[model samples]
Target: MRILIAGAGIAGLTTALSLHAAGLDEIRLVDAAPEIRPLGAGINLLPNAVRELADLGLDAAVGAAAVPTTELVYFSRHGDVIWREPRGRAAGHRWPQLSVHRGHLQMVLLAAAEERLGRGCVRADARVTDFCRLPTGRVRVTLAHRTGDTSTTTEVDALIGADGIRSGVRRVLFPDEGPPVWQRQVVWRGITKIPPFADGRSMFVGGDSTWKVVAYPIAPLPDAAGLVDTNWAVSRTFVPGEVVDRAGWDRVVDPAKLLAALDGWVFDSLDVGALIAAAAPFEQAMVDRDPLPRWTFGPVTLVGDAAHAMCPMGSNGTTQAIIDARALASAVAVEPDISTAFVAYERDRRERMTLLQNCNRALGPEVVVAMADRARSVIRPGPSARDLDRELAEISRRYAELGGFDVAAANAASSYSVRRRPHSARPAQQPAGS
Candidate 1:
């Protein structure tokens, strides 16, 4: 079957690989960018995403490029420890949670997809403009060149919209849905060389819902002065009706301004102000769309940020996208037809993504930090210390389970890999020569 994937980002690239592994070889990936470069800052891949990468036979490469995170610790605005737990293999999952630069991970996936699917299988400078279901049960996708008004079209058995939050495919599918809904929060993300904190392997999240900072080492090697390359994000929520223009990921923001947002937050292990001062960060408004009633419309379906864009609260945005790719490929390989596969894939992922979207909106596991801060001054006897500890752990545990990264379920979860069948390779489909 001829398959075309829109947006050559992590989600789209991984989808191509997953489809190839499932024994479906006719695949093409197109992106709006003229070139795919190593860009962006650090991102955490929970054990669940790591497992999917493992199934794709990419675990070794990814692990090599990233630091295996050992634990996650939540801290209050005053730098008091609120909750802490082991992560990845340390948490009992077979796979290790990895912290790596987003650009590095994307490059790894891009290399694998191109190697397996051939150089011609992936193309840049071609953006998906629109698509329609033809009478033959195939999709006619319109492609517009980035350089000029020139456009082309191709027919494919299926189209996967992994185009991210501002997906044009999603726009044509739900034109009236409008731009992503900003949650009145803004985040400044960057990586800086700083003294390693917490054994250089722990992910630290400090502050509460209104304002918070997350930092972790993305590299395994430490430089002189015992410093390691650390990734950090400082996020703050504005007033309910505050105005925040939807910004791209590449917008630069003043590091001083980000440090100012922290309001003098410093932990015994790390000083967030120093971290921010050490590097410039790109700024973006934290935004997401409401869960759609359906992601499948005939032979086309949405995945990743296109189908269910959630706030980066849970750090599962990339993880969920990778899972979507795997699940889509699995369904397509097992189901009787593309239509059935689309419906089945939607049915399986939409619910989970919807729950995750809502959970993120509710602050996910980070809610515990806010709760702990509030509990500091409770003259009225509420829950005891032990009860509160259980409650805090439960909050974190529930979010992990919902994201499919909880230790028990993740360790026991069956692989998403589909058995490969003997099939002849076919070149990617394209419009007739210009």
Candidate 2:
């Protein structure tokens, strides 16, 4: 069947690979951008997403480029280690949670898609204008060039909208759905070369007034270089009716502003102030969205940010989209009728998407405030240093109590394989030059 997919982001690329794995042919992907540019900063590939990448033969490439995060440390305003816990493989999960630059990850996926799907399978600068149902029971997509030269329409057996939050396909499907709901928070993210801290894993420091900071190492440099590609994001409550000016938004943030926000943050071992000061080319905020009612309509369906764009607090946005690709592809492979495939795909995904969105919303406020307060406390000097080992133990126990390691069961129950890889007759290769 011929398939037309909008957006060449993670969701769209993964969907193309998944459909190809399902033995479907004639897949075409389009994006509004004239050229695919590296946008966003970093993303965490949870165990579930790692498994999906493994299925597509991309685990080796992606894993090689990422830093394996073993622990998640939380801190209070006074740099006190409030809590810490094992993560990914360290937490007993079969797969590892990889922390990498979003741009690197996108390049990896784009290269793989181009290689496996052939050239011209994915097209940039092709913006979807509208869609019409053909008498032959097919869907025709009308597209326009970014240069405004000419418009063309192509017919396909089915269509999938992976076009991100401001998806045109979503508007075509659900005209009543207005703009994405604002979550009243602004966020700033940037990557910097800095020395690793706290076992070189990832850290989330929460403070008062709904301010939070999430930082993780993306790549390691050679020698005693002491340089690691780190990504950090700061978030706070935004005023109602605030408009984000794109040009002004992209302007570098004053280090003093960041320092003031994180003033009292006292996370144990590492100095939060030093870390924030070290980061450069700061990008400003415009965080998340409220939930959507539905993500599917007839032969066309939505995935990723297009369907359910939520706060990045839980690190579930990209992971869920990858899961959606797998689920939708599986549904299409099983259901002979195109409409039935779309229905089954939405049925399996909608509930999970809602759950994720709700989870993010619930956690957003507390986490944000905790981060802000922690930052302020560090500079103000208020509390006694908490015992590190005892605090970490308490956190680990709490995670265990909360069933943090039960991700396998959750993934299995969704009818999606946590890991999907074809068995090979030959054993895997050893270290290079072996």
Candidate 3:
């Protein structure tokens, strides 16, 4: 079947690679971006995602470019440790949680798509305008040039939308969905070269929802000064009704304002102030669409952020996207017809992502901090720190399970493998490397 995937970002590119590995050869990718620019800050691939990448023969290459996150630690606004736990292979999983630059990861997936599917398979600067189903049961996708010139159309047997949170495909499918639900929380994220941090590969999340900080090294190895590139994010929240008219947030912002909020967030091991001071910050509105009723509609379906743009809490946004790639590709490989594949894919993914969306809205394990805050009360105390730690550990495990990262199960299951790679899927002469 001829397949067209929109938006060659992480989700779209990975989808292309997964489909090729599944033995589907007639696949093409396009993106709204005018060129292949590796844009964005750091991103994490939980064990679930890393496992699938390993199945694609990408573990070593991507891992080499990423910091294997050894632990996940949480702190209160006052810098007191709330909970801590080992992560990835450090936690006994078969795969390691990867903290890599999002742009770098995209480049990795893009390179893989090119090598495996042949170059020029992904058409950049081609933006999808609309789609229509032909009487023959094929899809006709209208592509407009980035320069707004003459438009063109391509016919494909199937279409998958991985176009990101503001997906036009989603708008076409759910016109009344309105704009993405914005939480009025703006995230200031950036990378900075700083002295080695805790464990050199641990991830740190500080403060409550109102104000927060997340810092982690994306580089597995340090540089000349024993320093590494660390990604730190600070968030500023708006009071109710404050962001109703807000329009843009994913733009560069003055870090000075964000830095001030970290005035006293310094820890003996981490200097939040220094990290903020050293990096330029880019602001992003914390946004997610309400879970859709359905992601697959006939031969057309949605993937990744296009399907479920949940809050970037719980580190599930990207994780779920790659997971979508795995499940969708697997379904396509097993099902007899295109429609069944789409239905099976949706059945396999929708409920889980819906639950994840809800869990992330509740802040996942971060809710434990709220519990701890209530614990300080004189009348009705909440869980003590010791008890909170135990509770938080359960919450973490629950999310791990929901996110498809059961340590024991993953370690025991046969390695995630591509069941097929039809001859047509590979070019006669692959570049001498992956």
Best by TM-score: 1
- lDDT to native, each model: 0.84, 0.70, 0.80
Please provide TM-scores, in order, for all candidate models, with all chains considered together: 0.93, 0.83, 0.92
lDDT of 3 by residue, 96-172 (tens): 88999999899989999999999999998898889977767777899988676768999887889999998977887
By lDDT, rank the candidates, best first: 1, 3, 2
Residue lDDT tens for model 2, 38-59: 7778898877777788878897
What local lDDT score does residue 431 receive in model 3, on the 0 to 100 scale?
15
Lowest lDDT block of 10, candidate 2: 425-434
**Residue-level error in angstroms, candidate 3, position 5:** 0.5
Predicted model with the maximum lDDT = 1
Q: How far is candidate 3 from the true structure (C-alpha RMSD, Å)?
A: 5.5
What TM-score would you give candidate 2 relative to the actual structure?
A: 0.83
Tens-digit per-residue lDDT, 1-434, candidate 1: 88899998889998889889878888999898888898778888989899899888898998897999998998888887777899988888899999999898899999999899998788889999999876666789999996876899999878899999999899998889989997778888888999888777999988865788889999898977778999988888787777655544548877876666674788657988888887878888788999998898767889999999998886799999999999988887787666677788888899999999998887788877678777763223456756778888888888888999988878876557766756623322332111
User: In candidate 3, how many clashes are counted?
Assistant: 1
